[model samples]
Target: MASQAPSRVGKTLIALIKIGLYLFVLALVALVVAVSVAVSQLPSYQELVRRDDLGQMIRVRAADGSVIHSMGPSFGEWLSHDEIPAIMRDAMIAVEDRRFHYHPGVDPIGIARGIWVGWTRDDRVRGVSTIAQQLARNIFLTNDRSMGRKIREGILALALERRFSKEQVLELYLNRVYFGGGAYGIDAASRRFFGHSATELNAGQAAIIAGLVKAPSNYSPTADAEAARARANIVLQLMVREGAISEAQARAANPQQVEFVRTAERHNSARYFTDWVLPQLETLIDETVQPIDVWTTLDVGLQRAADEALNANAPSAQAQGALVSLDRDGAVRALVGGRDYVDSIYNRATQATRQPGSAFKLFVYLAALETGYTPTSTVVDEPVTINGWSPRNDNGRYQGPVSLRAALALSINTVAVRIAQDVGTRTVADMAQRFGITTRVDTNPSMALGTSEVRLIDLTRAYASVAQRGVAVVPYGIRRVTTADGTLLYQHRSDESRVLVAPWVAAQMTDLLQAAVMTGTGRAAQLGRPTAGKTGTTSSNKDGWFVGFSSGLTTGVWYGRDDNRALPGLAGGRAPARAFHQYMARAVANRPVENFEIEVALPDWQVEPDAESWYGAPDDYQLVDPDGNPIQPVEDGPPPPPQPREPGSATTEELNQEWLDHAIGRNRAPQAVPQERRGPPPDRGPPPRRQQQEVMPPLPGQRQSAPPVVRPTETPPPTIRPRAPGTAE
Candidate 1:
């Protein structure tokens, strides 16, 4: 019996020893598991998503930490962790993974569940990616939906978990996700749909965002509104099944009238300004350089106003035009570069160098004012010829003894010619250049009548001088540039110069221009605010121009056909000034009303043309100084009138030869001369313009008869589609 007891004790001891060995092995395995979990939660993997320019975009708002616009180097924005809503967090996690909080960034149970569902449907496991895994796929892995790639994504996701915490992973995921409709993440997505930021979103909004994660392209808010709603319903259903939402609450959160804005669509908001600003980039940046953003001083409301007015008032002639607005400091506040960008990138405001016609008279008048001429200076208005060139008033009728102010206010051409004579034509040209006229100038005396070419942008900035106290300032578009990481790149600075005119001169000029709006051609541009402006009409009714300014804004408007065809005989007050006024009304609506300071020394001058009595004409009336000194008329004199050849006193060719010799100097001639010189001496070539410009006619003072000849090719390309019978001339 003692031998049996000893055997039992030995057996019991052996059993206890086996259990102790098993427990020791299990304890070792648990320690390895815990250490692996801890190792997988580092934050160093953030380097994968880093950008070099991130510093430039980090402008901590002086007012708050909130960033204004995309102040960083990256094209899109990154949302901060604190800024995200709790509901958003829950929705994403619930939709992507229910075990997200429990798992170490990878859920084996969810994977098993997905594999089972996919196997039942098709021999495939669609997904069961945890939120961390989804983020890893989006940020670090290619989005190829395949098993091999999925395995790689899983590996990378586990690696990501090992390098970053769950919270950090979630934040990165939110910032890097693509939410469709040109929106990259929740921030842009919120703005696109709700017209606000992500912070302002409610549950419905948050749910819509979560639903879009599966198929952002198909269910984007802007692409298919109804489809997006259907997608939201699916998300709501899922939430209810998961107890994240109640049935009643889901029913109440109907997405039925919810507007889905596709922020990706190119909204041609400031089309005219967009058109006008293209070529100006030549001075701002090189085309081969990096893609830089241009932050123009565009006033959204004013731009809308201009678009509305243009659409409401545009002529039926293919519907095209532009409006430009500048601030008191010469910053282009708003610009409608054209009616549409897709139609033609021709950027009429900066590229179309068309004739200003009577609008050209504004510069002529301004130059006169700057050079010993005043608003009251007397200028003769009549049909007169220098050499053989004669200029008539717009109506072919003259108003005698008109004051300089009245002559300019009414845009009388003959008086403007006389004023140009008083100030040298070259002087006028130089002054126009200083005012920002970059287009080709004809150097002809008719340049005073704006027969020379001019673009809308330079023309607008030239007129901006009057409102800016005679200081010629280059227009500034971008305020500054920043790096991708909120670091400083560059700030734009303007190179301002004082154009030839004095402040007081511009002040008085502004007064005259204001009077034009009050009672003359620019009456249409009259706003309730204190304002000043000028109206321009080109020859044959080819173009219309209105340039104006208030204390806060300066704007210019131009209307014409790209083919140079004439539209209706609507004067500057018709559409151009109306557009300027409309844009300015909105541009200055919220700004304080103030007056331009009259600070230049006033120079006294005498009365001018009322509309009659042509003065400073080639062979007509003379320009007398204040003390009755005869002043020589300066002009690009016209050619000699055609002489009736003695059956052939000279062939039309010889006639043009003689005319060209005297009209232009022997060194220069019109391109039109070659065809006429080849044809017979005909009566058809001399239009009213040619008639008024009778200077240096081949054989003037002799009237003779001849057969009429027409050259179809030489006929000016139907520049003016004149509607008004009398005005067509």
Candidate 2:
């Protein structure tokens, strides 16, 4: 019975062993079938080789091909196996798969070892993928960690080894592998780390690049230089252990210094211009599959200068400043949106809209010139009220009468309003639109004083129009775009048109503005060459601008707080003008010196008003004495001798015709002025209140004097300017 029991136990053990063997065989067969099906669904080897579809970078280049900016996915230049350094390949093989050449794509021994390690350590940290297996997974599968995925990876690996040579597989692997920081392919990885081609990689650089295959971002030189060096040391040790490199070579290569290129994030000096270019990419290039290079009109030197100028002056205003420099052709040479682009990429130059203040007076004055109003035209500068709004000079004291040129140079608010009122506000707005002021402008009287908001670029373009002799300035940055292989994508065409202002008118406007810089509020922006522009300060100094241009470059600078908070004593002639001067100094340093095209006009300092008689008041309507001082007031009853105008021949009939024609049109001819008095006529209104007031203090940067008190018996009431929050008046 004992013998029979032993035989029965043996028989049972045998039967159990047989059953386990059959089940193992069945599971193995099922795995093979599943892997075969997955492999069949995989793309063919030829299809993978021929696939050119890859996300490439959109590189923005300066005129000299220097990289200004880059966007989109990274697909750097591909390198064949032969092109890749042997040291790099050997280091990669040693660190990733020790028995790469000996194995049939999937190493059973390696898998068993990995399994044993995982079982003993209770952590599946080790991977048993050969180079072929890694290539298969990288090319044909997602990074899934399931058993099914592992089986499919192994099957694909075997298929890859069967269909392609070992060199071919390695080449494909090196070309498509990700190496962190938007770098794909060994060439990109090499260039990104060493700033050179993979073929030229040294032993240390090669080892470091090869070590990134396991963890690219974790060991990137830019992100973690210490980790990258440690990884390279490990790769060197592994190479020695696998007999891929000699011990002496590994020892020498372990401590080798690696020089890494600057990270992409560090090269963001041109972010303001590049941000402007990002939206334009869609219009320039429809497809992003292929690599594209855009040649922009940006001059990097000028861009650097602009940035430095803005940064240096930012502390004064304690606010951000934006600058845009354009060539005579309206090509944007340099653009700096704010002090620091990385801190905030709002692109204030192109996007932010703020009131231009007196800078917008350019349009009003230009309109006046177009209507036969010379720069020497004179107008009363006394306090005026229009639509219940009273506008005062910056000094709170009017100059009584000043020339149009002097009014513009002095930034006389009342004079601009009077002119706009004379030639309908609508006409001023139309003239502004003709030049590149695209922002909405209210036709109110305040619009003449730059009450409307506008973009800095648009205002800069408007100034460029005057600088370019009345040519419509369309500010553009992109010059041309082409593929990496020279496929033409886009080229800018000249769409410039003639603005409403004639050349002579624009030249006169330029001459008037030049006087502004030479002696007016923009004296701070004076360049040795002929330069012209206007200064602007919004209410409460919320926005300060210096939009001026040399014969070669037109630049507009805006200094203000992001939240529209007022800056105390911040005027366009201060920080913004200084910055404009600094930037323009550099922008035109190399260019030829060109004076503005002006017809030897009268000097800005010359002041001679037409001296003549007026309506019934007196024969002489003298405001300023021969010495240019306001005449003192007299007693109440006796009328003082009339003040004579400055030296100029005055025509009685022609001078009186204007007031009489206007009075006839309005049916309110002043009965005070004698009908027979053949002389210059006074405005229709009662005498002003006789009150002695001293000259008030000037604005931050200005000089002024008290005006002569005119007691007209028949003069129209002057219109007053409206006051808004933050207004200088």
- Alpha-carbon lDDT, every model: 0.63, 0.76
What is the C-alpha lDDT profile of model 1 across 412-497, one tens digit per residue? 77667556654557777887887888876655556677777888878888777777777776776555444334344455666555
Candidate 2 residue-wise lDDT, 112-131, digit = tens: 99999998898784679998
Worst 10 residues of 2 by lDDT: 606-615
Q: Runs in model 2 with CA error above 4 Å?
A: 1-54, 123-125, 264-268, 315-317, 498-500, 599-726
Q: In candidate 1, how many Å is residue 348 off?
A: 4.3
The count of backbone overlaps in candidate 1 is: 80
TM-score of every prediction relative to native: 0.64, 0.78
Superposed by TM-score, candidate 1 places the C-alpha of residue 312 at a distance from the truth, in angstroms, of 4.4
Q: Which structure among the candidates has the greatest TM-score?
A: 2
